[model samples]
Target: MTAIKAADSTDQAGVWITLRESSVPVRAILAGVLVNQLGGFLQIFLVLFLTERGFSAVQAGLALGCYGAGSFAGVLVGGAFSDRLGPRSAAFASMAGFAGLLIAVLYLRDFPLLLTAITLAGLVGRFYRPAAAALLSELTPQHRQVMIFAVYRLAINLGTTAAPLLGTLLISVSYELLFWVDAITALTYGVIALLTLPKQAKRPARPDAAGRRAGGYRAVLVDRRYVLFLLATFVQCCVYIQYVSTLPLAMKAAGLAMLWYSVAISLNGFIVITSELLVTKITQRLPIKLIVVVGFALLALGQLMYALPWGVGVFLVGTMIWTIAEIAAGPTMFSYPGRVAPDALRGRYIASQQTMFNLGAAVGPVVGVAVFRAVGAQLWLWCALATMLGLGLALLGMQEPDTALARRAAAATPVELTKDPA
Candidate 1:
């Protein structure tokens, strides 16, 4: 039995090792993503910075909300750019624009100018994802798409883990230094992209291939099943954001120390980094619909855990449960749009998905805090119900990924111009 278990573990380890040996462009993109996340301190610190500068809590909250709204807009604009200009140009522009806007934010103290700077910064900053996602899809084989996205999530988790500590140290030195350091990170990513990523000619106008449409955002909007998927995604995301927004407050209300809350967050990140890839590998062969359903079910279960009697053990258990849900759902969720989208409409599809995520993120804190305050601990039960609803919609509305429609769309995709440099 011991030898059997050991062999299983070894096989799992080998899966990760093979995943790490992806092509050069994929690796480069992952590295840039990691570096970008390491300096992603502005969103974390913006509220505190504004409050420290004598703004009221309400004012600071409004600004942060504006930033989220900007991110939503950015995703839409970025997706359009990715579809029209190609991923390389969109990425370069996002990073460079983000750096410049961050600098503008550093110097501006007045409320109006500062708001504009941060909003534009968010707009530019978010452009990277659709472009990056499109590029990765273009570069990777279909069978490997989920695993590659798992690596992308791992990079984000690892960088997020390191960011808070680094941001804390820099803020102690000076808040201005924090902005400058973040700007430098964006600039660095821009430079790396310019030097390493391949350039492609603009996508030439072509008639809609069989099984695909040629129109831009309009095509994405009109897909009835895809729109249903987006709605489910939005609700799940809203439930997910409660972890950062109201879960801590709920814990505090339940008499748990702030330390326990921090520990829960750390555990969440650690679990994602350690388990996401392995879980993705193990579950990659499952139907996408099944994986997503299981994920949402886990999310519902985790939220229900919060409604149990208050205890440190229960809190940690809840955190682990939802962390697993996040791991199970994330790669598959992000990769689905890429897989099913018409090749011509890939960027817009991805962007539309991201827009739903951002919208949920922006609205979550407000709704979470409001519900928690009004209903006290019972808020979690409602959250669980929401997840179950989302799960039901996903089961009903999501199409089978291997259906003829999907296969035809995949076949219709044009050959990518850039050759594998591996």
Candidate 2:
């Protein structure tokens, strides 16, 4: 089959064809990320690791918070690095840096030392994301954008689904073994980035403006619409993260067994892996805003399902609803910022999205758990309401990629240098 035709890609076969026809570099990214995420057990185990080492629950949680803080800041730094050093180098650096830190973290004994190391580990670990994502965006043709990201998300979900198992098995034996394995996979990706990504992966650090000019993130921040979209994204992430933290608490509080909670999570992961790409085959054809809005709506509805009488049936069914929402909307959410960004600013744009996700993740547990403690299951209702606001923001914020930027870029007249000559 030739490269996938946009019109023809509505079918499942066309989806496979698209994957087959993707450039080798793109495939390399998918492979590397799969390997990297396979050992991404650190996030799944950090709290456990700390607690086992005799840290108080509050201290463990604080260490986790430090990790989140590092990751939150890392994306912005990574975005800048990707623009300056190119995606391949940025990715390699992040992987290599993270690989070193992953093992280094195992040696620290004192709580203060552990906190500092974990924070750096988190920062360095996340540094590759913007570069990797920006590279993918550049490599992919816009028409195939969402589909490719769906495949990308599939790679992630596939690894994420299994990482916990590997983590569980290894943690049973030794944290040392788990940490070692995780480090190896990260280093492997660094090698892959260097070997697979050709020199063409470098984008101009400075993208020229046809009519007017701005600098660094100032160019990105001036666009009110994009900022609004980010606000919407931040809200959506807070609600989505509830499934990870608060949902379990709610399950336990409501006199439900943890088995049902685990099953519901596993179900979501399995369905997302199996069906996200298939769903994207259709969703990719829909308007970006429409898909995002529908996703938020469905997510809200899923939370409402939890608000119903708590039971195994409710748990399974609610998970299914949100799983559908994720498959349908997630690729578009991840891909849209890159699509709308100016090429030079692509890294920053994607980094911005990642930052929101991290920020939401950090805040979600704190806020969701607090609310859950206060009003109990009523937290679900609040999340649903917040989601509506996100939906509204998304509907308002999404617009066509500005044609003027491209037109100006093509004209190739250097009008102004908004940045300093360093």
Candidate 3:
């Protein structure tokens, strides 16, 4: 049994190694994910960015909420765009539009214009999400979906980890430079998508006995188990986002410098980027329910640690604890959408879950900051409680992954790669 387990591990590791080399679109998406995420400076710095410009904390929170709201709406529209326009056009539109609008926001000194630009930037920014996710899902087989999403998240974590430190350096020269770099990188990804992705992935779907499409948002909404999973996911994301939204504010309040917050969050990115793939390989071998429960619990526990004190020690240690939760559960959480959705509506399902993530992002800061003002550091306890609530829902709502059906669907559709112009 030991030998068999070790052999299984080797095969799993090998699969990830070959993933980047497997296909053109996969490689393009991976590169784009990394580049875009690395330059994803605006979201990380928006709160501070606005505060430095003399916007009140509440205003910054509202702007952050707008970004999240834009992302939420963008995902829904992105699903349709992904289906109708194909991955290439959808990604191009998202990236290119986001880049242009982002630059416009940086120039506008008027608060209302700034707020409007932020909202538009957020809206256009996430348009390619469903397309990229659908593309990855189409390329990967069912059993390996977790592995693919792990790689997908690796790009995101690596980029995010670097972004904070990188943004700090850019701001040393000019704050505008940071936004410019972000816009430029976004455009780079857009160009890559236009050149590499298939013109469209949408095609006719086979109707079921009901003479209607097999999947839609309506279908997703009616599914109780999945809806429950999304609810839990929202809370889990709320807990996770606190590190970004509230942690910095708390640290600043405690008289700790931004450097400390940067180091703490950078540590999280480093740990996840360095270890998540290995963690996923092992976790995928475990039962889904066990990981979900422990992961959510640890998330709450980590935040609970923050109730101790606001020193660097508490911050870093707490960050590490929740980062473990992320490693343990990230792959399952990401790939679960692909596992259950019908091929026709896969993008919509991915968007549905992602909307929950955005909902958490949208709501977390506004609520967190208000609570932080009301109760001070006791806010950490509230974060812990919220996570536990999510855990209970996850326990009841999430079901076994439909690996057989996913495997069968993946086999039935072989995606043809788009040839680059000579």
lDDT of each: 0.83, 0.84, 0.83
Evaluate residue 175 in candidate 2 and report its C-alpha lDDT on the 0 to 100 scale.
93
Which residue pairs collide, candidate 3? 86-200
Candidate 3 residues 199-297, lDDT tens each?
Answer: 766466657665355356877786677899899988888778888789999888888989999999878878888888888877766666788987998
**What is candidate 2's lDDT per residue for 1-422, written digit by digit as tens?**
12224335644334678788789888999899899889897778998998888888999899888887888888999998887678888888999999888887888888888888889988988888898888888888776778889888888888987899889999889999999999999999999999988654545554447323575677678777788899899999999999999998878877899998999998998888888888987887766667887899899999889888757677689889988998889999988887888777788889988888878877888999999999988899999999999998888877544343555456555577699888
Native-to-model Cα distance after best TM-score fit, residue 122 in candidate 2, in Å: 0.9
Clashing pairs in 2: 210-408
- Provide the TM-score for each candidate, comma-separated: 0.86, 0.86, 0.78
Model 2 misplaced stretches (Cα beyond 4 Å):
1-13, 47-61, 109-113, 200-213, 402-422
Clash number for every model? 0, 1, 1
